[model samples]
Target chain A: MARAQWPLQHGRPIIEIVLTLAQGAQKVTRRLLADTGAGAMHDPFDIVLDEVDCLMCGGKPSKMVPLGGSYSGTHPIYVIPIGIPSLGFRDSLFAVGVAAPPAGFDGIACFRFLNRFTYGNFGNANEFALET
Target chain B: MATATSIQQLNRDLADKLVEEAKLDLPSWPLGKFVGIANGHVIVVSDDLDEIVSQLERAEPDPSRTFVVEPGRDYTKVCEIWRIS
Candidate 1:
């Protein structure tokens, strides 16, 4: 069976986890469009976990914290901070607020997500493959 | 009219434009902020943090406009993009 788990060592620190890929998940990310200071921005991406993927019941939600800012506005936002692992890439442990489901169970992948895998695109096939 | 767009709108427009640019060369996400236009140079911010920052520092940017990126967002919680010559 294909493995859904991976282990990594970051600067002498080792961590591991098992991940499940589902379809129709959405990825929320922040990109610098204008002169925004470094560290000035709060959580750039927030990913919401799907019910199927979310085995936790009572209050085990993708806990979101308020990142004070005028740009963030009055909107109340939350995020589920977790570690993500991919094949052939480094491990990513960032808080991804569960927004919506992804198109595929492959789960929502982001730039940080990119860091967790060996990524490349083939000609017209228009598909991405990853392994861990 | 204010002639200014909302952050959401700006992000959408930027995403579309950058995605198109990526077709030629995979454009980096969030080409920083478009602070103000001046001296014909479009000042860009450096969004990379930690190690990425170091990597970007060692590399050269497009020669035309010298993009200046403050380490992190300013006290305003926004980065300043100053146009260059």
Candidate 2:
């Protein structure tokens, strides 16, 4: 079993994880936020990515639709290989991507990814742990 | 099959490199805009999501190897927990 832990900041759980999108010999990586709340399946999307990131990562815009929340109008969707790494744990999965994510996050790690781990926070220590 | 362990290590390497590069590049990026990185380069920076996406498609065709980021903000800054009755 692999496990990793991150410290909480200002009463919030923040994890430093890398996201990778690879094609052949080309690969791009970005640090992203792993949100326990943001992990809900948005009907058709497995994960939500910033629109600009989606395209740069080679995700093709499929369609635009209302996603509500901080987003308005239709948003672009893309199919891509999304990789996540944290502490000593890492994995990549094929998922649908949405261009519109709330400001301040490169991307959101939702249930599609979070379900793979047993996670919890230790407020006394100001840390959170994710284990597989 | 790509095991979780292998993927995790690969992603860690990629993320470390990305963070390292961003330290040098992010200082010059325009604030309050989205930035996209592909092939280890800053490819796009814009406030318009559509425009950025369009540019990325033409520039980087492989979505898997691309990275996108927002500068100068903490990941937890805007997170909100809501309660519904």
Candidate 3:
């Protein structure tokens, strides 16, 4: 199994993601925050993307879904394929389109996406990684 | 009159207004496309956010009141996590 790792940004995990869109694949070299707490169980949104990023990346919402947490509302849900080359991970995942940013990150990688493999620093406090 | 449209300071009320305007003739709009609204009217509709912004700026007189977004029941609130630390 391949392993992919990245440095902690001010104590937060900033992971590199490649968004494969109809236009082409765009590498978000280091933009998405790896937040296991992003979405709850049963939530299909594996990532949270602001409208601008969603549109620029050519992500079109396949359906409109409701979200409840710090705020409660129904939002557009998009399907997009994301890849982490280092870990040899690639999958088609669902994402939510929002007007506001998810925390301060360009995007948020949630539980469904991160839980697919074993993830943690693995004793290396300076960095975090995923093992497939 | 001010020219140039922009999608900033977007509040729920404004978002609702845009959605309402778009819903007036949803039959003509394509699926998965974002709609730009300004001055309580639909400005442009496209899948590209940059194109929406560019067109809004060129067509609308007040860009500050412009907003481009998907006309769906989707919304997210931006607020700080309660910090007692």
TM-score-wise, the better of 1 and 2 is: 2
Error of 1 at B78 (Å): 11
Runs of candidate 2 with Cα error greater than 4 angstroms are A9-11, A21-29, A39-42, A60-65, A86-103, A122-125, B1-85
Task: Pick the TM-score winner.
Answer: 3
What is the per-residue lDDT of model 1 for residues A1-132, given as tens digits with 9 covering 90 to 100? 122322221211112224322233333222111111212223333222343343321111111233232122222111222333433322212332233333332233333343344433323233333334
Per-residue lDDT tens digits for candidate 2, residues B1-85, read: 5554553344335535544565577775444455555554567777654555556667766544444444432322232212111
Candidate maximizing DockQ: 2
Model 1 lDDT at residue A94: 30
Q: For residue B69, what is the lDDT in candidate 2?
A: 45
Q: Please write out the lDDT profile of model 2 over residues A36-62, one tens digit for every residue.
A: 555343233445666666655556433
* Local lDDT at B48 for model 2: 59
Every model's TM-score: 0.27, 0.47, 0.56
List the lowest-lDDT window of 10 residues for candidate 1 chain A: A30-39
- Candidate 3 docking: what grade? incorrect
Q: What is the lDDT of residue B7 in candidate 1?
A: 30
Candidate 3, residues A1-132: lDDT per residue as tens digits? 888888886678867777744355546542677777676543546777776666555553334556666334677665455678877776655667778755656677777778877889989988978888
At residue B63, what lDDT does model 1 achieve? Answer: 14
Give the candidate order by descending TM-score. Answer: 3, 2, 1
Positional deviation of residue B78's Cα in model 2 after best superposition, in angstroms? 22
